[model samples]
Target chain A: MKKTLVIDGAPQNCALTRTPGGMRLLVGERSFDCALETLGDGRYRLRAGDVRRDVLLAQQGDQLWVHVDGRTHAIQRINPLDALAAGGRGGADSTLAPMPGTILTVQVKPGDAVKSGQILLTMESMKLEVTITAPHDGEIAEVLCAPGQSVPVKATLVRFAAKAEATP
Target chain B: MTPQPIRRLLVANRGEIAARILRTARARGITTAIVRHPDEEGGLAPRLADDCLTINGPTPVAAYLDVAEIVRVAREWGADAVHPGYGFLSENARLARALAEAGIRFVGPTPEVIELMGDKIRARNFVVERGFPVAPSAIEADDPATFAQRALAVGLPILIKPAAGGGGKGMRIVRDASVLEAELATARREGERYFGDGRLFVERYVERPRHIEVQVFGDSHGKVVHFGERECSVQRRFQKIIEETPSPVLTPEKRGAICEAAAGIARAAAYVGAGTVEFIYGAGGEFYFLEMNTRLQVEHPVTEMVTGFDLVAEQLRVCEGEALGYEQSEITAQGHSIELRICAEDPSQGFVPATGTIHLLREASGPGVRVDSGVHEGQRVGSDFDPLLSKVIVHGRDRREAIARARQALRDTALLGITTNTAYLDRVLAHPLFAAGDYSTAFLDEQAAALSGKDEPLPLDLLLAAAALSDRQMVDAATSVPAIYAAMGAWRN
Candidate 1:
């Protein structure tokens, strides 16, 4: 079986093959005779030959968190269909509230052209001001929120029109 | 007022501090109650308390800050005293006054003292009038029209801070005079937004300053004493992330001088209970009083570790009108101690706060190590409150061993399902400057690149393998075997 996992924002290919006695795991160019023993409660002991290491694991949706050697690493399992649906904007068709917050200001409106990285709006959450910016050069299709509006996480604040590709 | 024992205590805070206070209150045979916001139903503090009372407001943070609600809860819970811990209503005079009016003791200084030290401008003026060293500065309230000119005249590099600010919020450093005006406007806005006080103050920005603070305890009997200073120079966004006892930079003579100066300030204010006096020490060894916190400080654990004193117990004792039985000479500190604040933030991402459910929480434990944790497994971490999840404190015979233990403790800590600064703090401890004990308030800013951990490449293969094997679908697919092979169990080719 093969899987693609995004680690630290970069995708890596992994292949797993079952052997008579155990399992052989290949990640990128490295291979290991890996056997994982569950110690219960998100704890696992991984044995690769004579070397052994303890790891803690938890999963939320497609995101997997693994703690090894005192550091926690977040990895995402990439789904081909989800990637395809994201398209060029990478799923960023609208500015979403990063956390539960109240909008403090809006710098753009529908029909306004914005450059990449231009600040579109500002919101306050946890007593800290968060600025939402354009992911790429695009035209604003609609502004869904206004100043003093309260929003929850992932709430769409502004929608952008599809970027117009330049002719070569 | 006559001395009286607190029969019932209500902790008017949450998180580790509440747990910390409850530990002492319970140990002393005092009944304890803790306030819990609805969102914090699963938090560790409420679970530790003998009784739990619900507090409500529009937001979780607001609920904690609702002075009226907290007071009413304390009264209804039949608590004889209230411990505000730190932050929230810890420094709010209104809470103290309200608690006092209800005939319940506030486990801190008098409300008048809290109001005096709560205002930065008023506190600075008080310290200056008492003949304590202070930095040159200008207050916007003194003359709003000429505040800008006066601030510029003070020096080239000035720090604009909100009069009611702490925890590094609403503070800006203007090295270049050109940006002073703009920074002032931003500072004022932040001040108003965060603290509801737009009043501004500008002071001389000490270059390469070290933040050393003394923990002072006082009582109604007019007695005061000082705990050795804690060096909290390693700060981010104007808040201390790493703190240690017996500042490595101070000589014996300097330590005595600084500690005495702190005690002097406390004595001058007639301060009671637990309070911390902060000073900005320059490279030249000269120190200036920055501010005096009228409540217990967040970094009090480092001092407690070295002095072998339960500061909360001392606060309770003082609140009961008991004098500090021991004099400054009798109070002694031993060995070295260090504390690392485990915050749910990504240091690599400019320390922006991170949020997620704490799916697995294995706090570090071992000899010479203590973890004051407020989180538990399956608890959700959000930005509604401070990012601090816990503190990792280690004590050793010396600074070197303490540093080593701190590094080891960081490795032992395993908080999964949320991004934290544990690894970043480990890298910081590994820095040569930190290990050598040669640093200042600007150390983090100066060594930001080296401490960022970006230059170190992660072990992608190992991480990916771990992730893959732990994944349910991936593991199921990889481990599944043919029915024939399953039927031929125990037979190897």
Candidate 2:
């Protein structure tokens, strides 16, 4: 089976072929023979050549949360179009993505006035919904991203314009 | 007069400390019970105890702090003694009094001593009156103006703190006199919000001082012994993240003086049971009494690793009116120990608390490594209580070997599900300043950028391979009963 996994916002194609003697795996720029064994309860013992690692696996929707050693990374399997569709929507005077994830909801629109700390949009990263808020009270110059859109890190989701002072 | 033997111990706390107390209590053949918040219904503490009692409240941690409920439960359950494992009601005078009234021994100091030392202002004054040095401080009630004037004499770089609380809550450092009033008001507001006590005090902030504390234990028979000291200078937001014994700074003479002062203060309070005297040692060896934690401390294991004395056992024996048979001269310290607090926090995101199921955990073992963890695999870590997941302590012949062992232990330790500060701790241990043992309380703050920043390039390929290995579907692929069986379509052969 062939798969493309988005790791740290970059896509890596992986191909796996089952063999009587463990399994043959091909990753970007490298290929190796590895045997995967289940220790039951979402844990795996992966032996790639002489290197062995204990990994904990959990699936949250389409994303795979992998924990190797002490570090955890949320990797999602995405197609080429989905990867291409995910673009940088960030710009100066806009809310940039704190992490690479799908925009779950956009709460603001072009020309909408927002107060400081107002929730402008929400993005889902690693199965956690993070609310993107307005840095300061301002009018929305443009809505750069929509719900269900995948965005990379530093992608601007919404642009803001400074509120005009009232002339007394 | 002989004291009542503690046949049953009811730990009025939660998490790792509770589990830790249970270990010692059970070893003594004492029946143990743990009071847990309903949210922590099946947490490690309850699972480790002989009996688990639920205390419901508005929040999970609140149940642990419910003095009336705790005392009532202890009496109803026929507990001989109540152990308020650090935090919660650990230093609460009312709980001690309540337990006493209920005819239960409180495994800590008396109510009067707790009340005296629980208040930061009162404790400082009492210690200073007893000839123990304390930081220059001024206490005021809702009068920032008066505090502002007094603080000017106390000098700039003063800390505006709540007079009745600990844990650095409602504490602010004033570098400029102009902002002292605002900071004082803010501190007072925070104090009132958190502790419901608006009383505030200003003290001369000891900039970059090493936090060296001596563990002093007193028996009911008027015997007190000091267990060296633990240097807890590596702190973040006033919470200690790393602690080690034989503070890299303290000279032999200074260590003796601080330990003696701790024992002297404990004796002066007529303090019984386990207590810790915290001191802020200045760069020039001048030290001031910080406060006395009148119960077991979170980092007591570091002292235990060096002193080879089980402090919880001592607390139990002291409350049972047993005399400490060993003298101060007999107490010995061997090897060096260091502890890293593994918290369930996201370091990259300003150390925000993260809650979720701990998917997998591989605790570090082997020589010179010890892990005191209250969490286990598949346990759901809720955001209702302290975020401290566990502690990794390592001991070696010296500080260098201890550091090396700690680094290895932290590297070997793994808690895969839910975010943690383990990687961040590894980085801190690897820092040159940390390796040189030349860090102060400001170490975390001063080196925040270097510690948190991605100093090394991301190993994307390795991560991808690991992720692929951890794919849940990979289990099916690996465990499938051979491709030939699926192709044969349920053949009897």
Candidate 3:
């Protein structure tokens, strides 16, 4: 079975496929051939070129766990559509996506000084908002996107002219 | 006592809690040997342990909960004692008995104590039999006829709790009896799946009762003690989001009574360990025993600060053949303390766990402030574990002062690259009920909107701050600019 793992909230995707007698994986644009076998119990031994390592893994049903070096890591699986669980509903005043969700609300106009952490052009991905907030005390320098704009992660929502006190 | 002679210890758990306990152990000259999953290493255990052994192999069941594997590790590492943190085998009586049989000291209560308290129905019955106030509860028969009869008498809005489970799972409030039969069936199934005991119990849901839990310590010599109480009123989905000591609403008389009752329960159980007796105090000051956790709690640090005692140290001492440090009269409740769980979730959303890279991290600090964290900058936080990133604990001379100080600490805390509940915590600490000490388990569920203000219009200044930050990122990165095609020959020339 092949599984797609989204890393670091980035749009980039990683695919891990277990093959017969071997393993193939794709990370970003890179591809590699590897050997994978269950060491014992649930432990797996993965050998890829010069890198040979023994890994202990636990898949929390849907969540993923991988050990690299000596440190263990738990990478959670997030549905880009359920960001509203953070409690911020979709549809706050038209400026921001409200929560860290995919942009679903775009209510503000250009030169809208979204106070601080104010609603800017809203972006909703996993039900949470990328509702870009006012980064510092400032006036609305520019509005980069319009309402219903589905921007990718890190897409600029609005620009602010830094306030007098905001400058060091 | 020469500081209870230090020696090697085995921490039998995982995640942030295990990490926190190891830090405390290391500070006092105790060597730690952590049991690691075949694939699971690093975290707090690798750095904290002087020795390490892989358990059952790799799967969480194979590793963390594999009591046999854990016993083998302790024996191989020559660990004289094993400290079961919170989850997994922490409250497992059979595991505790196994450790005792293996001649290894279990840092929690005795196996017999674990068995008694681990059984929710029996525990409740025992406390009530001793004349302690237990929420009026009765088990509904599995038979639909008897269950319906029990449901009708129990009335609507009763809490159907699995007689054998904790963590608020296998629980539901049935406002309409029409669904009681199905609800009972579902609860029984879940209870059996989780706790292996599908016994269903009914309790009149005490709406708006503040979820207060008393920290109690007992010794092997049958000496039981109470160290005041913690207000863990702020929660969602029955999970604690914030906790504090010297509950805001407790008068000296009320506090004394509550603590006394908690100690009574511990004493009755012959409980010998660091444990918490959770109670639900009604609006009128009538408190009911929710249950007793016969192991160290997740929020034991706040009690440590208020009382100036390292509870785990006491646990270590007592387990290592020491006497109870103080009597009830000797121990005094001091100051005010609060703990905010820094979760890895976006509060504006439905508190869904947010997985992201911690690009920046600056925790709160100052006089009477303590932060127990598992992640730092460059740390990869995910939902694979509990969403609690760290617990920010603050202390002050009084509750009001503590409230103000907690707000300041929250304001000072800034965790970027991922959303956190820091702001929501500020709102909770500022809530009138919380400040007035009139909170309950229903406080969040009832006044969630007012406390969190998820809908209150975002002020313009706050909006501007967000815009400015996003704008600045664009100006600084230079990566936002479109790629310009350069004529290879001309550019090279």
For lDDT, candidate 1 versus 3, the one ahead is 1
Q: What lDDT would each prediction earn against the true structure?
A: 0.86, 0.81, 0.68
User: Compared with the true structure, what per-residue lDDT tens digits does model 1 show for residues B170-198?
Assistant: 88999998898899998999999889999
- lDDT string for model 3 (B246-351, tens) is 7777898999899999999998888887989999888888999988898888888889888888888888888876887577788776888888888877665667
DockQ of 3: 0.02
Candidate 1: residue B99 lDDT (0-100): 88
What is candidate 2's lDDT per residue for B1-493, written digit by digit as tens? 6766789999998878989999999999999999876556356777778998777787676677789999888988999899998988998989989888888999999999998998888898899999999998878854655767887788888988888878777788899988877887777876885577988888899889989999998888888889999999998778899999978888898889999999999999988988999999888889999999999999999999998999999999888888888999999999999999999877778665666677667789989898888988888876556789899999999999999899888877777667788878989888999988898898988998999846555545555655566565643554465755432322222
Best-first order by TM-score: 1, 2, 3
For model 3, the local distance difference test gives 0.68
- The DockQ figures for the candidates are 0.44, 0.15, 0.02
lDDT of 2 by residue, A1-168 (tens): 345888766777865545556565567656666765778977777677666777666665456666665566667765455556665433337789876566877898988888999999987543234779999888999888998776765777888875466889
Model 2 clash tally? 3
All candidates in order of DockQ, best leading? 1, 2, 3
Kindly give the stretch of ten consecutive residues in candidate 3 chain B with the minimal lDDT sum: B461-470
TM-scores, each model vs. reference: 0.94, 0.83, 0.70
